[model samples]
Target chain A: MTRIAVSLLYAGALVVLIALPQLISVKYYLHLSILALIWLIVSQGQNLIQGYTGYVSIVGAGFMGIGAYSTTLMGMHLGLPVWLTILLAPPMTAVFALIVGYPSLRMKGHYFAIVTLAFNLVIFIVLLNFTELTQGEAGITGIPKPAGWLEALNFRDREVYYYFVLAVAVLTTGIAWAIVRSRVGQILMAIRQNEDLVGALGVAAWKYKLFAFVASAMFAGLGGALYAHYQSFINPEVFGVAQSLDAILAVIVGGSGTLAGPMIGAFIVIFLPEYLRFADSFRLIIYGLLLVLATIFMPRGIVGLAQDLGARIAGRR
Target chain B: MIEILQQIVNGIAIGGVYVLIALGLTTVFGILGIAHFAHGSVSMFGGYLTFFLVAGQGIPLVIAIPVALTAGVVLGMAIELLAYRPVRKASHINAFIVALGLTMMVEGLNLEFFGHEQVVIPTSFDRVFNIGGVTLPELRLYVILAAALLIAAMTIFVERTKTGQAIRAVAENRDAAILMGVNVRTIPLVVFAMSTALGVAAGIMVGALFAIAPGIGEGLVIKGFAVLILGGLGSIPGAIVGGIVLGITESLAAGFVSSAYKDVIAFLVMIFVLLFRPQGLLGKAS
Candidate 1:
């Protein structure tokens, strides 16, 4: 993305985050927008790990669950403020990822995915069975919101939480962009294509892979923490197999390995199902068909297709 | 002793279904290197069709099974031609996405065609056979026998037939097979048809033994893939052994350990196997 595109995106984001809520009187749409932003943040994290790094981490929902549960538990038990707990969730997930990723990431591509998936399933099982800590499937309720300056804005408002999530989304994007544009991104991409070649070049490719895993885990954690506060109630179902597939689905649909792909993916994933409600019974059928056609024809996804169109139009000028 | 024997019997019965599913997966992955995420869903399609034939249309079990298997063959071929053939030379990810999409599409289709209820293929084999103080349900016995027969048949066909040789050649080296005048185009369809037929058979067995539902295939496919990995990605015998081991392991785990965490234990076993031999139980070390 160019500077102009970046500036325009930021401006547009600012309008949608700050101004659009005021413009749109419908409360549900604002709520949906916030949900999309949270998913976008998570997918951006997924993009970093799976798309750029080329290691299809399937435990994104696992990380998200960990983040949500940890933040919620700490808040409920330890009396930590929502803001502090949310801030603490990502790093906590990162530490967990270090242990999980260590044994799993050492394996090859698809094997790594299975391990992560197994871990995801295991985590869900733990959350369900370790009932005392997570409250099991009944879920944790009565979670507090961020009680800071936002409180003055009547943080009980969904719009305020939306803005908070939007800010986090922007921060997530900036961090991912910075990491990808630098030497770090190139090294990770290289590792994705052929880790052996990068290792031959003395890149210590394992470190980069681990970094991507941890960073992405943290990103998922942020999304989860925000989600916990936003929803005010969460359960083990949030980290389900379907949700695990959701992160990958969003990344792929929005054009994996692109800066804005995950955001676009988040948009489609969060809102598309809602929009498809019009299709009624055939909603999933259409969604599935669209997904198949999109990937088969446009492997680069919607963003990549847009880039192609943009390049064509720009070249004419 | 009877419980252990019965567990083994139960394990083999389910293992038979896993073998069929994993065999389908292993064949596709072996030949084309595509994960064929839709394989499970496709198998579900077979199961659903069998249910429709047996229950809805009132077709008898003996006749419906073959018809379902044939339909599976046709569907498999169509999937190869339309879904996979175009992207043969594209990046592996494209095909992977196609597989994922196919999975969702098939799942959606299953839901549309069959309502959100589980269906069992009604069979006459409801009797229980007892031997040496162990009891075997007639349905489970047939399932085990059918799976064994199918595995044997598949092994023979792959080993003996000229076409099987061609498929093997393609699997070993596609370019080399092409150079050797093997019609590479036809092989994928054949492989798919055969693989899918096996999957349909497995679906039929699962439907009869347990129940066929929407997400059942997904769970079955996940187990199939685990078997694929446990046995060895491309090895047929590995798939067979892996399927049985996984089935038994899951059965034992459920019996002895927590029933809810059986899937987790099964996967943990796979992970442990990976630690020892990542290439798989039967795969040659990389």
Candidate 2:
């Protein structure tokens, strides 16, 4: 059956991912893969809100910053274990999301997008100016990776961290898959289709929206925490509006409204730049043009395009 | 009292710039219902162009201003025809996505052409007039005057001209406007042209008053949107009042409160407006 073939393909892809670090000789590519995986986590969360719920929250990077800072600060000040700090990041990020989401979720469409962008700027500003805590633009260096677990496997190696991130990415993707398949996901999609109608049908639409927003923020937080420990450095620069735009780009380019889209998008947004070092200066221009052209010509993204092609070939047979 | 007056004067100049940016945004949002997020980046493009003309190419400031304005108009038209027009009938989100893409493209183009370092447009108006303990620089005075003149011109165009009335008609009811023999196709172009021109003027003012750098456009555009929300989405008068209020609030906040969090205060004010009066100050409750 086609279902069996699809599952086999999924299994094959997982196998390749697990073997990627070993297969590639260059340690740098492993670093890039880890980054791509991190982005995958963030974009999956973005997909829940933007792709499924039909709300474009532009503060993905900001929430990531919150998660990153929470883990770092707790370790620095409270002397908590790195593992515990990372675990606490999601709940901390979710609390901030609730505060932001409650007031912002009232507005629909462009209003919501703009409000979230403003919040992103607010986050960036605080990180930049709150020098006593965040160290401003200089950022916190020497962040400890989660150690003391599985002593045989060194966490310092890029390959070890790669597997760790891949596991988290897979788990989060599975969670996203579950959410999309559940009854709650149906209502979220309904809210996307026609929120007013959902409310008219006596559904508490705002609650669903808040849930999506907070859930998305938690994903960003987890991604940020991992990024911090993996890189062993934390800075506000990486967690600005630009990175949030990258999250949006990942979802849109990879295929919004599709489970596989963010994974594909995460790689493209991260690796495309790495390969385009030749056109260093024109990179952003080209990157932007690609986004515009892709949105206009291939709005459904690569996954959707593949689906259409598959249907056509199957029909021909 | 003198310090307050000084702060108000300082705020007014920047506020004038905000008003122009918001005016440009409101016209497009009002008529086409597109957020046109690229307005700010494109405005920065104008500023960069003017800086190149005056500082790099040795052109006169007077000549450079008009040249940049013309380029903005042409660019605006091209944007509508090429980028936005294709996605016009798609879901509203598609247009916004296109707008976001356009913003990045324009921003990237600005960086590639202008380089990363900040540039201030050279102006010879160096005289400062002290009026009862509140000093007003000659450059700031000219900026305020130019902004006032431009705003007045925009008001007249929107209020009195036939094309303006057509624009208003389309904004009020697109299907009705089409039935009434208004050329809906041309309206978006005109609105973009006028809006871009207004934005270019703001950009030039900003370049002269402060400096035009890579990230400044994004900040300006966000403020412009805040003004849009504060004034009321799609309300012209609301943009004006909202721009002024935001500018003054920022000035006072910086002067009295922590200057570091001035931008935060502006956003907070915007959030406050959204919470209490989502319709905006002059906007009708929908």
Candidate 3:
């Protein structure tokens, strides 16, 4: 009953957000909100591995690239339906995650981060140099929009797509929340705290970590597929190391452990810069400074900070 | 055969730079247990400083190299004191966060000062030396020699000096070293200084050999980490061996196999290494 209520509340909140662009007249605001939504999906995926499982992956963008390319290639060359390509991209990226994660997860701490970092570099190079297939740095342009049944419904505007994206985002968030609330989530938390203890308890820690990694890659891939269709273009930069680092930064800045933390962090990471566009060359400098300040003061993230405030209020009462 | 040898020679020259970078990273990671992601950006800053000195101010290369290296030492000390020291007692994640933040800040600083265009430090050595039909650029020869000299100096410092003994002792057992009256606080500063100087040297080589740009550091750091993994994290000899292995493997793969898959091939080698020996090629079993 609680799960149903919580999911419904989330769905309602998402519906309101979906309707926001229609209510507002600002195109720039809508654009920023769309970017926030895209980042929210990626960061949420990041939170699965880094926040829940404690394996800090820096290849979120690589997975995104995998999905984007898969969808774009399938839709463009194979002439597959958009829905089918979207379905296929996540699993494809999952396979890649498994391949990369198997050897990488053997090492702990910074080793894992570095291996994932290398994965991003390798993938980006492939995307750039594979000119015959990927069109090189020029990127694949004019990717078809989400078609068939959705297009049949005559919903093609940015407003209509916003609802579609929001619905998927909410559904994925609900599913992720459910998984985190389940026994599997508890095992992940246990692994995060102490892998040896969890292994002693008969849990195959490596398998669980692999599972989290694949799942995270799946969501990132899904987000990328959605983004490719939405943007109508696919580029190699989508899989660059900087994009991967930005996703990790979003997870860190927004709050890593909590369910809503990645979402909040996604908003700050995506939208904060848009607001600070006037800062020009100083924008990244400000961001770097903000990140340092945020980490020092709110190690737990903004969601964690909010929880602390809520606890303080309750204590005062 | 000639092409293969040429590629190998090229790889060795580039591998020398990776060696210096991996040495810097390993010292900080091995001794202090911090990932130090900003090492690459700091190295790039060193490159930019060298460019500013040699190109802008018209200083001789001899004077500029030491000045840039000195700047690196000061920057590393500042990073240890300001960014890392504050979160010494906190969760490992705090340091990780700070490293990421520092990386962004330094990169941003480089962009602000250096602009986006790739900058190469002008060198007088434009001649190519060929031996047995294999050509070696004079610049690459210098890079290789300079890297060798730095490595030797670093090895001697770590092996022979009292401070090096203290550093090794701390890395082996920090609590034991503290009990032995080794000044633990000063060790991180020293480690950072040494690491930064090594990174600065790499930056100088890169500037002369290739060019310095904004995103170049990210790529170098990834390669450095690859060396760290291939050689074994925290192993000095491992870093040297691993750096050479990776550099040579990447060049050979690019030359013989496919240039497109060079990075993939290098990582595939790392993955294979991990499969057989998870501790790395020369890394002691953890």
Candidate 4:
């Protein structure tokens, strides 16, 4: 009953937020919403590895880049359907993640973070230098939007695309929540808390970390595909370290270990800059200051804070 | 043979900068168990300050570097005191988050003060020396010398001095160091100041040899961490060797193979090392 009530509240909030772009009629807000949705998906993906499994991946944007470039190239060159490209991109990203994560994930904690950070750097360089395939910094432009069966309904509109992205976002979060609540999530948390103990229990620790890493990559790829199709342009910069850090920041600030945390984190990280447009230059200072404060004061994140308040109220009762 | 030597020389010069950056990071991580992500940005800030002093303020490169290094020391101390000290005993994740935040703040501050334009310090040493057909730039030579000097100085400080012994004591066992009258709290400040000064020196080298921009620090920090991992975290000797190894590999890969694959190849090597030897090249197996 509580879960249902909580989900309903989330649905209501999501609906209100989705309706906002339409009601405000501001192109900027629409753009911001689209960005938020992109970050929402990315943050959720990051949460899978960082929050749920307790492995810090600083390369979320690299996976997103793979998805973006794969979808863009396939859609543009191979003349594949946008939808098909979206479906295929995640697997492609997963394969890359598996290869990279195989050895990289063996190193726990700070070592893992460095490895992922290296991955991000390498991926960015590849995207920038592979001129023949990636168009070298010029970026692949004029990516086609979803058409055919979906196009028959005139889903080309920004509002329509917003709804489409929100639907995927909802579905992805649902899947994520389900996974986190399942046995796999339990195993993941166990690994996070005590990998040696998990290994003693006969669970192949590396296998589970690898699984989480690939799954996280798939989510990043899915988000990247959506972003590519929505924006109709892709660049090397999209997969750079800054974007990856933003994803990690979103996961951290949103509240790790909770479903709603990444979503809220995505909202704040993506929307905060938009809202604080007047402080343009000093925006990063504010962001940095906020992150410091959040880490110190609300280490459990906003969701954790809310839960703490609720627990206090219940205790008083 | 000549080409290999040239690449080796090139790598060594670049490796010197990496060594300085990694030294700062290694000290902090080794002593405090905190990942100082902001070290790169702070280093860049030092570089930018040096550039401003040289070009904008009309100070000589020699005078500007010391000023910037001093500023770096102060900034490092300030970060430890203001940003990290309060959350020292908190969760490791707290320090991690603060590190990320401080990285952004420093990068933003650099962007604001330096503007978005890339700045390079104008040095008088524009001459290139041809040693056995391997062209070595004068500025790069100076960078190598300066880095060696700093490394030697740091080694003496850590190995010979009483304060350095205290730092080593603290790193080995914090509680015991505290009991032994090591003044554990002041150690982090000292570590940060030294580290930041080294990072500033590297930044100045980059400014003179390459350039300084907003996101460059982020890239440098990543590389520094890579060196950290490759050398074995918290090992100063490992940092030096790892930085050189990474720098040489990157240059050789870029020169021989594809520049695009330089980073990819370097990381692949690190990954391979980690798979076979998880403790890194110099790191002891826990």
Candidate 5:
């Protein structure tokens, strides 16, 4: 059956990812893979909301920043283990989402988009101006890595962190797949198709929207927590609208409405620029042109394009 | 009182810039229902172009401006035809994607062409005039007058011209306008052209008044959107009033509260306004 083939493919991918750093042996590639995995975590959360629930939350980077700061500051100043801080940070980040989502979710479509953008702006402003706490844009450097048994895993090694991130990526994707297959996914997809119909069917659209928003906030937070520890520094700029745009670009380029989209998107978003290091200064020009061309010519994204191609070949047989 | 008056004067100049941005944005959103996020980058492109013509090529401001304005019109038309026309009947998200992509493309172009340095268009309007207690610089005065003149011109054109009437007709009801013999297809082109022209005018003012560099367009576009919401989406007069209100609010907030969070305060004020009037200040309550 196709299901068996798909699971086998998934296992194969997992094995390949686990062996990626070992095969490549290049530290730069390992670093890039780690970055892609981090983005994958955030984009999956972004996919859940923007892709499935059909609300474009542009504030994912802001929540990610919140998580980064929470874990970093807590681990550094409070002397708590980085693991516990990461564990607690996501829930704390979600609390902020609850506050913002209640008011912002009242607006529909693009209005919500702008409101979330404003929230991100607000976070950026606070991060920069709250000099006493956030270090006033100089950024917190030398953030301690995970300690105790987590550090015993030798995360200081680039290869070890790669596996660590891969595990998280797999877990995150698994949870996303599980959710997408459940009744909740059906309701979310229905809302995307027609919120009025969902509401008419007695599904309170707001509650479901809030739930997805909170779930996404947690994902962003987790990604941020891991990123801060891995990168060993944090800054307000990392949480700006540009970072959120990168998430959007990945989701759209990979295919927004599919589970497979964000994973593929993370690779393109991170690697295309890396591959085009020859373009040097003009890298973003090609990047921008690609964004416009892809959106226009293949609005369905790469995953959707692949699906169409596969269907055609299968039908030919 | 003098400080308050001074702040108001300062706010009005920047407000004039906001009004121009909102006018361009409102035109596209009003008629086409596209957010046109690239309008800001296009506006910045206008600034960079004028700067190049004047500063780099050693051309006069008078000559450079018209050339930039014309280029803006052409670029605006190209955007409609190339980027937006194909996805006209598709989902709104398609246009949204186009807008996002166009913003990046244009921003990328700006960076590649203009580099990362902030350029201030050199102007000789250095005379400072002190009236009563408040001091008014020659540059700010010219900026305000220029904004007023442009607004008046846009109003007259939209109110009196036949093309303008057709544009308005399309916005009011597209199918009805088509039945009434109005060429609906050309309206987007005209709207984008006029909108980009207005944005160019704003960009020129901004370059002259402050400076222009990479990423500034993003902030301007956000403010323009805020003005759109504050004034009422698709309402020209609303854009005007909302822009002025936002500009003044930003000025006052910076002067009294904290200049560090000046941008945040503006959006916060907008949120406060929306809390009470969800349709925006001049928006029609549905």
Candidate 6:
């Protein structure tokens, strides 16, 4: 719990992550790691709104879709560099988020959740039915990788892309950390505990909620852009309500409102299915059971559970 | 004009289904203050059971339906006591999560039991009636009538029964109801039973009229919530009117506009309603 211990822990993690590609025997695991890292960015953003702000936005994957499409379409039509398209993805997604978050942020609790879910369904509908642009479920394939800029290393190589995603994940996570530790995060948390009390104290709670919502969308956008480039295949199917729910699961199962929670959760959500391949028929049932059990017994998630155990051990010692 | 009337008729049938779904949702939400997101999936479970009984086994449609309805009531009670009751004292968010988890579990169970293919309950109602201009199919007419009958019965039960009075009292104020000697413990069980029974009826209607599939329940639940928002969250009459209006809107949208974008249009209407009238059509303006 000390500063040194925390720093040492982070350093140890960074070292392990850096050496992960070399340590893994299977290239498939590397691919899964890359996916986990991208999810890490999304889960971090999800933690901002759902975990800290106490508002569950089910449109995480919808915004990610917007970002993915923005990056893909812009690159294809405008003949722009892949990096430039990826860079613009967040801002592009932010515009849509602002449009959605403006009216949506006015509601609270279940109402907010329902409205956001509708938004997600709408996004998916548009992506699927608007075939002229989104290609109608067939999806846009043969996407270009960020190859020319990194000519020294083959971007198509799983290990190289893994490292690229790791850097981006670390950077985005750092941004999330900064936001959470800042005054904005404090107000957001305040809004979560009691929005009316915050408003009674003369704070514009809606503004903070809107800010968190928009920031979280931007993170999703970033993750989606990275996902599009990494997989070189962008589809609306991958960016639907189910993926958004997975993002929420990552936040809940890992530990809401904690820095390391999403990091651990993202991997679990992505890999848990892979590990549960033996029980393919029972996968969904098991998944649902785990979510229910987690919400009931481990409401604080793994991080909170670990922290509680640590405190108890310290007390006994 | 006849085309328009036909669309309205079509919309009414589907709207009736939406009303039942929303009614089930509103009652639980009204009395217990739980969103009960799994209500749709649970309803689908009922439909699937009826399908398995009639189609897979040799049970008659009439016999299979009541059995499914009874099973639905039992499942609803189990959900309340096991999944939801444990988190009664926790934050509302925890309850919502449990609802979501229950949804996944029920959906998973449906998939496990019924496979992934869409199933439609076969019926012998193959007649059609022609009004002055518009046409009405026999099955759709039956669906509309059944829904109306259920709504009327629900209204009477809530308005005329002692237990219904207890439910409304609990919804108004739980502590006050407890103080007034209302057995608050069994009320949730009763509400879940009634709500899930209504949901089962809706599910059977859906199976008989259209088809029940893996993702259909999720979509239906979302539409139910949309109706809840449109009619005011906890208002029974609002849910009825909202369900009808939404069904009609979707029918008209599909008939007049793009069929592919009808769901999108319905959602757009919901968002617009939220913007202009946050209290809903029938909800008291707070």
Interface RMSD, one decimal, each candidate: 1.7, 1.1, 1.4, 1.3, 1.4, 1.0
Please tell me which model should have the higher lDDT, number 3 or number 4. Answer: 4
Per-residue lDDT for A18-37 in model 5, tens only?
Answer: 87877986789889899999
Q: Model 6 clash pairs?
A: none
Error of 5 at A302 (Å): 1.1
Each prediction's RMSD over C-alphas, in Å, is 1.9, 1.3, 2.2, 1.8, 1.7, 1.2
Q: Estimate each model's TM-score.
A: 0.96, 0.98, 0.96, 0.96, 0.97, 0.98
RMSD of model 2, in Å?
1.3
lDDT of 2 by residue, B61-176 (tens): 98999999999889988999999888887666778878888998898899888999999999999999999999999999999898889999999999999999999999999999
Error of 1 at B54 (Å): 1.7
Tens-digit per-residue lDDT, A177-262, candidate 4: 89898899999999978899999999888888898899999999999999998888888987898889888888888899788899
Candidate 3 chain B — worst ten consecutive residues by lDDT sum?
Answer: B86-95
Q: In model 5, where do residues sit more than 4 Å from their true spots?
A: A148-152
Please provide, for model 5 over B1-286, each residue's C-alpha lDDT reduced to its tens digit, 9 standing for 90 to 100: 9989989999999999999999999888878888888999999999999999999999999999999999988988999999888778756666777888788878888988999999999988999999989999999999999999999899888889999899889888999999999988888998998999999999999999999999899889989988988888888899999999999999988898899888999998887787788778998875
Instruction: Rate residue B61 of model 2 by lDDT.
Output: 94
True contacts kept of 3: 0.59
DockQ of 1: 0.58
Tens digits of lDDT, candidate 3, B71-122? 8899889999988888777677667888888898899899998899899999
lDDT of each structure?
0.87, 0.92, 0.88, 0.89, 0.88, 0.92
* Candidate 4 residue runs with Cα over 4 Å from true position: A1-5, A148-152
> By summed lDDT, which 10 consecutive residues of candidate 4 chain A come out lowest?
A147-156
C-alpha displacement of B237 in model 6, angstroms? 1.2
Per residue, candidate 6 scores C-alpha lDDT tens digits across B169-228 of 999899999999999999999999999999999999999998999988888999999999
* Fraction of native contacts under 8 Å reproduced by each candidate: 0.46, 0.66, 0.59, 0.85, 0.46, 0.68
- Where model 2 places Cα greater than 4 Å from the true spot, the runs are none
Candidate 2 lDDT, A11-77, residue by residue in tens = 8989999989879998788889999999999999999999999999999999999999999999999
